[model samples]
Target chain A: MSEPSGLESLYRELILDHYRRPRGKDLAPTFDAESFQVNPVCGDEVRLRVKLGAASSDELGGTDILGQVTWTGTGCSISQASTSVMCELVRGEDLGRVAELEAAFGRLMHSRGLGLESEADEDALGDAIAFEGVAKYPARVKCALLGWMALKDALAKAVAGDSSPAPGPKG
Target chain B: MTGLSPETVTSPTNAHGLCGPGGLPDLGAPREPITPQEVERIRRDFPILARKVRSGHELIYLDTAATAQRPSCVMDAMTWFANNNYAAVNRGAHLLGEESTEAFEDARARVARFFGATPSEIVFTSGTTAALNLIALSLGELAQGEPPASSAVPHICPGDRIVVTQAEHHANLVPWQRLAARTGAELAWIDAGPDGRLNLESLAALIDSRTRVLAFTHASNVTGAVTDVARLVEAARSVGALTVLDAAQSAPHLPVDFRALGVDLAAISAHKMLGPNGIGALYGRREVLEQLPPVFTGGSMVEIVTMTEATFCPPPGRFEAGTQPVTEAIGWAAALDYLSHLGMDRLAEREAKLTARLLDAVTGIPGVRLLGPADPADRLGVVALDIEGVHPHDAGQYLDDRGIAVRVGHHCAQPIHRALGVRASTRASVGLYNTEAEIDAFAEALANVRPYFGATQ
Candidate 1:
């Protein structure tokens, strides 16, 4: 028999695998900027640290590179797996391209269960596409976006050189 | 609106004589413990219990601790009021206005009687949070000697103290913290033991001569643990401190008499007690009401008005400042009538059986660690469980897919969850309409949690 329509799409084996054994889950010892994100409704949280490479002036334009994307969080399968997938997709990419990826993922989340029109966007999201069913639930959408929002906040602080010491993740 | 006939809305068999002898369910004698026949009859009174979810499964509502589903009578009462008797109260002179004001005050008298209080002592509020805020903010003003205080002020000062508990819901905890900050008074707490019961020994030590207020929940909405109210009240009374009871969780499931409970004030919510939302009650002793200055001022609450200054009205009228929840209060009175017809003692006994079954079912499942008291006699139907490896969100989703509704997370009592050594837990609470089969289904769903998360491997 086929699985239930609501459960299978959101809890695909690939998503569960990533959640069971997350990637880049350790906080980086040295980082330019760090930020903590909390889903106050459910008490899920993520403490993310990002290290940025020195800016290089390219022939096309000046671009900032992301040296590492590392995080430690306690949340459900969707949030943990989304964080793992995000770290894998953006670790070695330039900061500008990573921002574009975040925007694309955000659009998919707001799609209300309908996926992207273009295959290019779908291919860009990789395993993140498994979260398409999550958009159907208004409550779970925030879980899929926790890590990406943290990355955006952390990157902004890293560029501003406002890296003052902050308290670690709370229980 | 759905049909309101007994056969259509109520049970076909009418096993409990719901529509038979007396107009309502009889209250003279205690009913037997809940049977399947009783569940069938009670389930028919609530139309929402028959609803189906996405998977074509019947909805099992186990989140009654958050808010309960209203019976058809309560909804019908609200609809009848809106259709026949909608008017702005206390400000109009027409026939409808007089009718509306009469109905509103009559509802207040009924609610007051339900809590063993006088109509003048009960103030209608938006809900429990608003009621608690009204008390806390007014106490702060009373301490400041606002509006030229009478003899009622506690006169809190720099060296005074306010005592609460670690397990208080944020609604009760945050207000007292703000009161302490505003008055420059020290804040203290009664800690909980491993079983989630308040430590009365610590409470005795905490209540001193300088303690002005002692606030706590009559029952924990998260843990299902009932507090020792009389003991705590005695401690506060010995020191001349006022006692404020959060009855939001207890008023629905238990028989509560604010006067007999010996607390100076109590807060209750209508939605939790099977009434409409946006209406609750603040019960204060006549003397305590005199001491608490009005926090919200305007319109009907004022006794005399001037460009620069105004004097407030008496106890309840002084607190009800604006256009009140008139229709909601009428419906709440109907809810109280419904409760009384069924009998609070019988309802409590039935809930005890359901809670015992839920505890046994969940505890028998492997890897599920039940929080709060192990004895059903000690706790009510709110059961929070910690599955070893499944986060509460995941567990909640797993159960939701199976058409079981349970609350997951810290449940607005974060400090207690921290004390219990977990980020969050899944809670399955019951109301009067819950059945044994539903409890079995919930436990079966919970048993599948670890396996679904692949933790068993």
Candidate 2:
């Protein structure tokens, strides 16, 4: 038989594993901030809650520890799996580490399925490396990035203490 | 390639793009079926059809409902015009300008003749969305003041009902919704059945005397159901409401006549009809065109301009307000010419066969539900499917792997999706050139999706 195809590479066993039974699939009862994001194209949505604990001070200047990351969403396998992977990777990590992870993930998504050159960046991404395949299809990048976007927004809302309404979607 | 004689290739089309002797298909011409071999010959015209996708898989293009693939002849026409006569149309006194202007107006005349309309009645717009918005904005402007002494543009006043159908694409529905919001005209829609067909039972009560405009699709982009234009037009006419048809889907697939449909105004996108993007036509009845106010302002549309005020040009010119999509118009006319040469009735008959094959092949697959009518009659080749335990995004990717290009997501018709009780669907639409073998391959690929994804709880 022939080798794995591009679409098969996108839907790896790890991705289907997470999609079937996602971690952080439930909304946390208590959280510092919450953000609701929707992919307008497919109507996929994620309401992500980020809870920050006291600063973890090995390298902390003013960075808060991301104690918990929980979300509730309904979408395609890529979106659901990406959210699951993101929550698993970022929970209990310091804010700085989370930022680095987010940036690295962004680079991976923009890599056009070639993947990150830096081994450290790939290791940091963990299961999200399956999503490098998502970048090949430009339309699906939004689905894979949905949860990460919600994390960014919720963390910003938490930092500013701005209790604004969940920005439903960009007009 | 097999040599094709002129008689074997097509029915005779006159210089004006009308049928010469066999008579117009929309009139009384017998259905001349396009054979599979003829379809293969026609496919040779489209260079993109020969393209390989992904890992050397033959391309199976099933997204013609969104936008059609252009043939080499259309490209040749545009390239020829640009090489020989590229200039600002109807403006410069140069010879090239005159030639360009002649080509541009000739394109308009061809499009008008294609729609059984006069050249003066067709206004070129960016696309279907732009055409719809222009009509809505113009109507909204009319509602702001008294009806013009010479204009037939309907006045949509406060509390007037603007009726639409639930199966309308966002392009048709959203404009009317905005128009109603701006003018205080109450917006309403004919509800869709479970199968996404518009429920005409509600037509009588909805389109009453208080209705100003009835805007709807000639055929639904998502559902593939052709709306009964005559029924809707009759209701609108009895109530003195102007009818607006979103002919973007139907015009490309069938033999369409604006006069025969009896809709006061209609919109059609060239891209969906094997022409280039950024060009479409807004067809208005001559009387309606003569009376309607222009939506866009400035430049070519205006006749005389003072420091304070300006007088506008007639119908078509009044609507086309800037440096026109001149090259695209030429290409669109060439596309019309190509379709005219094919004999629309024959093409329609061919597509219907393809539709029947597609429907049969797809519906036979277990755990797949059709988003439109199962009956292949009245419906075009546009087919949207709801796959069990598989989101359209994932399913679309599955199909894409095999070099099948289908549209996923809500298809910009979220309301109809909601009506059909689906968030989104994977749509496979056929063009005149799509073959039965492609449909079989699509079906086989689709069957593997559920097995690959497993049963999602």
RMSD of each: 4.1, 4.9
**Model 2 agreement with the true structure over A69-153: per-residue lDDT tens digits:** 8888779999999999999999988888899999999999889888789999988888788788888888889999999999999
* Model 2 TM-score, 2 decimals: 0.93
**Candidate 2 — which residues are off by over 4 angstroms?**
A1-3, A55-63, A163-171, B1-31, B148-151
* Top candidate (DockQ): 1
| Tens digit per residue, CA lDDT, model 2, B1-457 | 1221212212333232432211234544435677777778778878899999987889999999999998776776677667767889888778777777777877888899889998998999999999999989888877888765544557877878999999999999888889999999899989989887889999989988898899999889998999999999999999889999999999989999999889999999999999999999899888887777788899999989999999999888999998999989888887887788787878888889899999999888889999998888969889999999888999998888889999999999999998999889999999988998999999999988887787533
TM-score of chain A of each: 0.91, 0.90
lDDT of 1 by residue, A10-61 (tens): 8889889999999999988888898899898997889898998745676425
True contacts kept of 1: 0.78
Per-residue lDDT tens digits for candidate 1, residues B96-155, read 677677778878988998899999999999999999999999988887774444354477
Off by more than 4 A, model 1: A1-3, A54-62, A166-171, B1-34, B146-153
DockQ (CA atoms), all models: 0.79, 0.75
Q: Identify the CAPRI category of the predicted complex in candidate 1.
A: medium
